[model samples]
Target: MCHTSGVSSERAAHLLRLSALFQAAPAADVQALAELARLRTLRRGDVLFHQGDAATHLYVVESGWLKVSKLAAHGQREVVLHLSGPRQMVSGVSVFVDNARYSASAAALEDAGVLTLSAEAVRHQTAQSPALAQAVIAHFAKRHVELLERFDDLLFSDLNARLARLLLEHAPPGTTLLLPTNSELAAHLNTVPELVSRKLGEFYRQGFISLERRTVRIVDEAALRSLGGP
Candidate 1:
């Protein structure tokens, strides 16, 4: 199980310095915002929220991981998004829009520490502070752009490319890949378990990747990229 630790004073201070999301806010305002947030812990596989459920708060992870996914009609799950490690916020877009129902569900991938701020509270604070308002707007804009990029990938990319990109993006730096269950990897890549299994076998035989139980290591990134084709 992944363990989540409370935000240390140094980390909290560092988060306030982030420029993209809260650039317009002054350092003092950022610090105040941090203070207003409440921290919570989550364990791996724990559901943070469910689809169609009321969206009340935005969460910022202090540590660990979360997967944001949607459930299909056939009882299949698709991972639509991933979230921050330390000092990164999750589901900011949904909360900022004042949407009552969540578009997706979030589950802890590991033990995670998060700070949650009620939408009402955030709105109130932003109302009195122009900096906070700018921050929220930036957050919304970023999420919109990210979703558009994902849409492009879904429309134009093949399954192998999609899976490779997901692995490279989420895996630890310098790590070739992670061996996740076919179902889990399929969900993230927007594919089916059977197809994923077949592709994995093909890649393994081609010397593009090495598979051990549930762990996958990329042996040839160039070869994997070739499978995506130009």
Candidate 2:
């Protein structure tokens, strides 16, 4: 990770500027860390790592999307932690963990490019840069809050409410909802696939949505919003 690629300092700084994680680092630190990274490309569905894999790199999404997910006990099912888009950093905490093993897996949700920085190099940088250390701490703290928020939603919100909100956010009228399958939705909503299927059927019966193979057509936005109770 500490090895240099012999990249131009100008190019290094430009890439550093583009990454939200490193943009605020000192100029010298930016140049140093950038030299320690290499670029990688991934096609849709390519896995970056699996749970318990050695957390050797900090991946910065330069373009397209990635999904972070975890498997249930016995690997019976998987649940998404988040969908990371361009400019987002994945596994910032992985660099600092004592065991340095990824708690979740990451995969390309679409064709993508990422800057892979050596975790050892990043940890060394963090040792010298208080700002980078603080930033890493903040990233973990933010994800902690997000996990709690998701737990709160699952505990307090009804299935109708959760499905309603998801539809409102991702699948509005005239738009085809993308790759999230019923199994994925069930995993996200903390419910069973059969339950999700029944709910979708209920929505269809109520004229709130229409379904086709791998897609949901939003039909009644206002009614769906009403179903998403606060």
Q: In angstroms, how far off is 20's CA in candidate 1?
A: 5.5
Q: Quantify all predictions' global Cα lDDT against the true fold.
A: 0.69, 0.77
| Candidate 2 lDDT over residue span 121-219, tens digit each | 888888988877777676677778977977888999999998888777666577655445677778778899899989989998999988776567899
Q: Which candidate is the best by lDDT?
A: 2
> Per-residue lDDT tens digits of candidate 1, residues 12-102?
5455455346655767767766666666788877888888888888777666667777777775646655544555667666665665678
Clashing pairs in 1: 179-215, 179-216
- In model 2, the runs with Cα more than 4 Å from the true position are 1-20, 160-177, 194-230
| Candidate 1 structure, TM-score to reference | 0.75
Query: Which runs in model 1 stand beyond 4 Å of their true positions?
Result: 1-10, 16-20, 73-87, 175-180, 200-230
Question: Best candidate, TM-score-wise?
Answer: 1
| Count of residue pairs whose backbone atoms collide, per candidate | 2, 0
